[model samples]
Target: MDDLRRIDLNLLLALHALLTEKHVTRAALRLHKSQPAVSHSLAQLREHFNDPLLVRKSGKLELTARGNALLQPLSEALGKLNTLLGTAPFDPLQERRRFRLALSDYAARLVLPDLMRYVRVHAPGFDFAISQASRDAMLAQLADGELDLALGIFPELPQDIQVQTLFEEDFICLADKTAVPDQSGLTLAQWLERPHVMVALRPDANDEIERALAAMGLQRRITVALPHWSAAVELLPDTDLVLTIARRAVGPLRAFRQLRQFPPPLQLPKLAYQQAWHIRKDMDPALTWLRQVMADCCTTGMPSG
Candidate 1:
């Protein structure tokens, strides 16, 4: 702690610039200071760290072992500091930014159409790239900076991953009208007797519906397991297979005249669909705006009931 007190915080910036540029003159140009000023800061940095951070090699400067070790941590620290102190308001109209996102196909169908329309009219310069992955993979991607945001039913999360609840969704049963015959709903016995179509990203994965059934010592026959919600719904129109899916996912497929939706026979926990990002992006204005827009789209665009 005493060592930290003796060192100047500004010298860290100079050290970063010097190590990044590897030349005092170039570092000066980056910092907008004269060559001598950067050189003086470099000398002070060497004294504080007790290492010649940069060394001359064949007439060109290169980072030493300690300098190389410091570069990534120093860069990340400085980036966080800049985010902390920088408060310039974001202008979506002028800034061109592409955000990478991960979400299930169900969420993509429920949210993307509305989100795209809103961005096109409001923030034309902003763009999005979408991918889909499992929950654990999504969290790992968020930590590794591979994905900027993820939207799904994130029930459990790491401390460093921030989350915002977009909306609560519940299960609805979909089947061919001829298959069920009853327009009201299925009884628990009838529901269990039917061959079901399970939508899961992983073939072996058990979803909330399966878990809920297991809790009651009951399990249904999943004749077909698929990773896509759209494909699963399409199969329901022709076959006797029943699909229990999120209510929001049913809105877009309402045009399927042969399919009918009914309340699930058993009570299932409401799914809180959320958007998650790394804690490092908490203060990012662009991400903040994007999250809000997503929440708004989920609220106003999707069927609430």
Candidate 2:
């Protein structure tokens, strides 16, 4: 602790720049300092840590084992310190910001259109980058700061993640109209017998539909397994593949006149679609505004199919 107190914050910042840039001149340029000043800081850092944090390897600067170990935590600490001390009143119309988000295609279909429209008119300076991944991967990305927010069915989560319910949805069966001409919906036995198209993002992960069936000592044949909701719905036309998917995902099928939606034959648990982020971001004004906008998009009569 005494050693830490003796170290200057500027020295830590210099170390971060050095480890990141891997060259004294580059680190100096990044820190807007003279090369000699940064070199002096590095020497001080090495003496304080009792290790040559950076070494010349293969004729280039490289991090030693201890330096490599310090990079991630040091980066995270600097980030938190910046957030704590550097935050300013966010102005959506003036501040240019980009957010990274993860969500299923269905959630994107439901929320993004409205969100985009609003941002275009109200927060034109804000930008978004979106990606799709499995639930576990999304959670991992959130923890690692790779993703700013994720929207999906997160039934369980770690303590460090904060979640807010956007909406609640349940399963509906979508099938080719020609395949189920009855229009009255299928009986439980008939539903179980038909080959199903399952939207399993991870090949090894079982979905809620499978879990519900397993509780009743039943299993349905999965004729197809794929990760995408949009593609899965498209496959229903001119085929016998029935997709047991979230009701919200059915909105796009309005264009697929050949597809018909039916209530699931058996009761399934309600799916709570949510937006999640690392708790470390809770105090971020920009993210707070974005989350509220998303919640408004969900509640303000966006199509629920």
Candidate 3:
């Protein structure tokens, strides 16, 4: 058996390039080194492997039987090394890397438009897929690298994950403009007394709006319950009153040109919408770019209280 520790890293790279391109000039181009440099490395690999890894056949370079057998493992090992060294440059503008984010419809509506605009201008080639998943499932996907980010009001997050506050907003009332004296604000008492539309991804015990209301010795009269925030906006234009979620959910409703915002009558505990991701990716260049871009979009597009 060969002493693996005696192996030359550069020879392994040469072997990989040779197996991939099968031609000296082409492999040199792939390595961004001169043809002579690649040829020299190929000789070193041949001596190390004690076999001609590639041979000329019908005027084209072809791999030997040993080379053919070594290809898969060699490629896999080189790939592991490349990833560890972060050699694969992340080109969001050209690389079709897909990112999945788990967020509620409200958060998506609030943040996605701006996020898309940024991608169009900056990372035009990258794609993002957002899905509404349960908090547990979302966290699991994030931890397992199946999801890139989660945007919502996470009351608690795993210690292995890192959360950054995007924005904090107090609860507000959404109603027809005529319902409120001034469209700018509402009193807590008015919010408690009004008929509200409650929105949630699924039937859950802990509702942030309700919790905020209860802390103030008040509770909103939730006349209707819906699964998504967009549905609530659709209902807002026809009805005189409904509780419109503040921060991210407000702009989408106003775009429909029917609802107005009011300061809640009483002080409701402000909810902090955060962006969470795996701690392992904290220093990754690609992840950093994504985090900054989304965070910028959140701040620039969503109304911060």
Question: Which residue pairs come into collision in candidate 3?
Answer: 185-262, 185-263, 186-262, 186-263, 186-264, 187-264, 187-265, 188-264, 188-265, 188-266
lDDT of 2: 0.85
Query: Model 1, stretches more than 4 Å misplaced?
Result: 1-87, 252-254, 302-305
Question: Compared with the true structure, what per-residue lDDT tens digits does model 3 show for residues 22-61?
Answer: 7687677757899999999988888888999999989977
Query: How do the candidates rank by lDDT, highest first?
Result: 2, 1, 3
Candidate 2, after superposition: displacement of residue 265 in Å? 1.0
lDDT of 1 at 68: 85
What lDDT tens digits, residue by residue, belong to model 1 across residues 36-69? 8998999989988899999998997888999989
Candidate 3 residue runs with Cα over 4 Å from true position: 1-89, 177-191, 216-218, 237-240, 252-260, 301-305
TM-score per candidate, chains pooled: 0.72, 0.70, 0.61
Counting clashing residue pairs in each candidate, in order, gives 0, 0, 10
lDDT tens digits, residue span 245-271, model 2: 888887756598888788899879999
Report the lDDT of model 1 for residue 199.
89
The stretch of ten residues in a row with the least summed lDDT in candidate 3 is 296-305
Candidate with the larger TM-score of 1 and 2: 1
